[model samples]
Target: MRFRKRVLLYLVPAFVIYSAFMLIPLLMSMRVALYEYTGIGDMTFIGLDNFQRLLFESPYADRFINAITNTLEFFLYTMVFQNVTALLLALALTRGLKLTGLFRTIIFIPVTISILMIGFIWTLILNPNIGVLNQFLEVIGLEAWATAWLGNEATALPTVAVVNAWQYTGLMVMLFIAGIQSIPEDRFEAARLDGAKGWNIFRHIIFPAIIPIVGIVTIMTLMGVFNQFDLIYAMVGSTGGPNYAVDLLGTLFYRTAFGGVGGQVPQMGLGAAIATMTFFYDLYVCHRHALY
Candidate 1:
């Protein structure tokens, strides 16, 4: 009984914190999602009307659809360019690179920078008028390639997605590196003795060993990609400007909950509905993937 009491002392703080920060908010959001409530007005219990309107009857259906699709595109881009590239880098680093420590630090530096700062920095770099990128293009006689990266609807979403991928690639790199380091070196030696080289070694040995780590990385990337708001919010503002080119579900929730420059009146209920649905959708995707 004394030992159990001691164990409870250690667990109680964590339980309290989790309940206060995560569990409480999750329950509150689900409850709020069923009501018609603005920030100021009293809430009215409306059953699933908010969800019905959001999915089938909302005037902003088209925009919401676009946001959902854009978010998926962003996730795909990250999976391919960021996570895959990070895995490649980690693999390369394992091939007896000398300055491994320096390289790791340099790669991870961008992740240490604030998301807002990275957005502002990239904004300055990609500016059409006087940005360094355009100037560099002009100097190199590639002026035709220089364009307003964030302003043009065609390039805006992809550009922001790439920017976000760039910032987070280092995190995936570190994850991959850790997985690679934990691998048994004897396995590589055995493969080397069997004349397996290059892609064969990686495919047959290293790749198989890292499947569990890949699952973890995939789930984390899924969560981060789905919940992405900071970088887009910082770069494109709350409105997701230039014709909502880079709008995401996160931004949609924010815009709905709080009226923006060119948005509708506060629809806190609808915003909560979107939030609740998206949270579960992401959870379901991750859970389904994990189960398989």
Candidate 2:
């Protein structure tokens, strides 16, 4: 009874904090979206006009579609590349090889750095004129292959996607490594005794045990990638430049609420609408993924 009370005591404050900070704000934002806000005067009661405008209006409608598409594209690219690369790294590192610890550290190094710093470093690396990447390509007599990576509309989004994948793959590798390391050594010994080695052992025992961990990693990566804004914002600028080819929902929401220049007076109602839509979309995605 005392232990239960102690646990409840700790949980109470945590719950209160979450409710006050996250839950309340989310509810308030939804409420704000349902109402219409003007700069100075009282807010009017407009049920779904904001959403209709966001969906059916001229400029806003296009922006909304672009934002949704860009965000989804970014999320998809991150999940596919990051997980595959991380899994490959985990497989290689988990083998009882020399210098495993050093390799693990090297893989996880990027995850330790700030995303903003990573963005800046990648931007310089992908620079068209003075960047080492282009310089190396030119030296290799493949100058045509050395076009501006972040500047090209065709490659900009994918370029950012690769950078994001590179940065987070290390963290996923570490997670998989932890999961792999937790498997019982006796299981391996038994498999070896049963003439089960190499891919056979992995396919049977190691793989199954890691599925749950991978599922967790997948959900986390999905959310992180879906909501990603900082790296793209930093590397490509907030507008997701090159004619907004990289314009993600997060960036769109920012630009919409707080107009780009001259503090053109924020449209809290529209911003709230975008945010509310994003919130629901995220909820649906999370729920769908959580089921598996």
Best by TM-score: 1
Measured with C-alpha atoms, the lDDT of residue 227 in candidate 1 is 93
In candidate 1, what residue range of length 10 has the lowest lDDT sum? 54-63
Candidate 2 Cα deviation (angstroms), residue 108: 1.0
How displaced is residue 57 in candidate 2, in Å?
2.8
In model 1, state the lDDT of residue 2. 100
Best by lDDT: 1
Candidate 2 error regions (>4 Å): 1-9, 38-41, 190-198, 261-265, 289-291
By how many angstroms RMSD does model 2 differ from the true structure?
2.5
> Each prediction's Cα lDDT score?
0.88, 0.85
